[model samples]
Target: MAASSTATIGSYELTSRAIYEPPAAAVREGSRILDETRRLGSRYGEDYSDGGVESVAAQNASAELAESWKYPRQNVFRTGAAFWSLLTSGANDAAYGALIPYLEEYYNLSYIIVSLVFLSPFVGYILAAVLNNTLHRRIGQRGIGITCGICHILAYIIIAVHPPYPVLVLAYCLAGFGNGISDAAWNAWIGNLDRANETLGFLHAFYGVGGVISPLIATNMIAKADLPWYTFYYVMIGLATIELVSCTWAFWPNGPEVYRQTMDASNEDNQGMKEALFKLPFARVTWLCAAFLLCYVGVEVSVCGWIVQFMIRVRKAENYPAGMTSMGFWLGLAVGRAVLGFVTPLLGVKVAVSVKILARLLEGSLAAFGGSGAAILPFAVGAIAQAKGVKTLQPIILAFLTALLGLWLCLPRIGRKQD
Candidate 1:
């Protein structure tokens, strides 16, 4: 009886040991699963174990990790999305050119009055610059963007309804105000993004696209007489509405402002905003930007705004219709800006800008002397050379001339930096 009892006890003990001890295969699989879970949790923070620990070091680490995950992803999406929004918004400016004829015909506006209508926006631009930093700080980038969108829509509506000439000027001013606000605010926002210089070029490229499309659409609508001239304003109003919605939804919580503040604080710690604006570094950059902007706008406005008149009255170029000339100019501008997008990075901003300015001067000189065909040749050559590289001394000379001109403009505000 004692021997039998002892055997039963031994058998029970063996069974219990086998049940508790897992097989080698099962143990290896479990370990691998645990390791994978730990690695993934570290990589993506999916595991809450470390996150739940109540320590200051752990909290700081988690916060940093969260920020790292958020900004890169957000910036990637925002850069492209913002570019599209800006493009659509800017395209509406093409309507300004179409309005010239209407104002001349319906309002009996003299050349001075018409010119003022074109120039009034600059006033708004100047005013917006004065108020931009403060307004952005008070309202945040997204809020300011929404406000600009609203103002833009309203301005378009006012113009579309054929307000009196004074009121029309006011409407144009308001549109300019919207544009200036958006330009300053959104540019600052984009500059705050990672890879700012590259992203900024892309963002501006969209503006170029918008500028191209605007004239085409405006000219087409007018040519068709599909609706009253004022109806074009409605189209713009609709675009502004879309911009408002986009600003509100896609760019909310205002992360851009925080970035802007950080950047501004770091860069301008000792300087007042106004003082900062006039400082050598700031002045140098601004002078370059201004020169680029001025020459670009002058060339673009002349081509789109006056080309039709020039063609019909001056050159009498073949296939030149009232609208066709403007269309061609817009197409050229769009293509030029698109090509510049890729070319600018390669050449660097200073060189790319010098090239553009040189092209403008050459085109202007050619137009003055040899008429349209000769002017077109310089532009065409410059565009091709941008991609193909200059093979001859002529392009090299032109490029040198452009650099000299840019330096001339830049030297007054800021002395040349030491090599």
Candidate 2:
């Protein structure tokens, strides 16, 4: 059989690479291509003779497949840059909780007024989500890397100057926008890797690492050294500078044109954001996951943002011990992601997510103790704290965790359907 020979099997063209290449790659690409075909409503169940097995096996080689770090080689640098970017985000988020006391003391502000810092970031995040596709269309990942770095750098510089309350809130908004862009871009890029669950586990584990260390450093600077609250941001500025350089260099080759080619944007049937949100099984999964994460992150950052205050005010803990509470939380999160990444594939997504949510619920319930949209829930919790008390966080945590579990259960398992 010539490489170009036609093997009619449900409207697909089989090629030589499918027969010559390893079956693993062929099977992987074959399944993905079939999924795309099914999304387009194609029917496939044709029979062929044993002699036609290779012909039957042939599939489009250009279809994207999950890749490894070494294949492209440059991905190694790209992945490192992503890891650093996430670390910076973690550090930025965790530092706020530790600094809350100092912020109040320095500015002579009440809880709700300070909570505006947490709430202000919400606007930046929403804007990022709205503009993400447009940014991708215009500048590609390279542009995203540069833009995010600049946002962080400028934000940190503004904070380091000890600006007024309104200006400080605006600085956080810029930082949040940077965090939002980097979060979306890197997660999408890394999700294409082989064993993505495990890879992403390590990727986010770095986030945990940052979360763990940030409070420690920020706390010591203020409590022990008696430095001003804004000094920590100078360090943040340095990190952002490095992030800008590393990411820009790594993604320079992957500009707008390359992004278009990689995405196969010219394909008439390619799914858009609208289709992804409205498609049958995908729609169910998407909505459920969004709801679950809104609850999940609301809990995670709310705790990171307010747990220090809770401990200091309600538990009567000193600054260092109070800061440790947040550090401990991040440590557990990091360790769990790294360890469970290995276990999740065996358990499957549905079961794994259920277990995680249930465990978080149990943790919250037991705490009598513990613990945003990326921001709203955290902001709401802070607002509630102003009216009720930080102690109310315990019940709020329990409620959100319970909701997380419910959302997880509602998620439809999206898989290859035989039709």
The number of the candidate with the highest lDDT is 2
Clashing pairs in model 1?
none
Q: Please list the C-alpha lDDT of all candidates, in the order they appear.
A: 0.56, 0.74
Best by TM-score: 2
lDDT of 1 at 102: 61
Compared with the true structure, model 2 gives a TM-score of: 0.79
lDDT of 2 by residue, 1-419 (tens): 44444444422534554554446655566666666543332344222221223222233222232255544789889999999998898888888789988898889988888888888777777767666656776899999999999999999999999999899999999998888778777776776555656777888898889899899888888888888879999889988999999999999888888767765644532353344457776456555666666677778988888999999999999988898899999999889888877877675545544333322222111111111364677778878888998898889999988888888878755452321
Predicted structure 2: lDDT:
0.74
Q: How far out, in Å, is residue 32 in model 2?
A: 9.9
Clashes (backbone N, CA, C under 3 Å), per candidate, total 0, 3
CA RMSD per model (angstroms): 15.8, 9.5
Candidate 2 residues lying further than 4 Å off, grouped into runs, are 1-66, 265-272, 348-372, 413-419
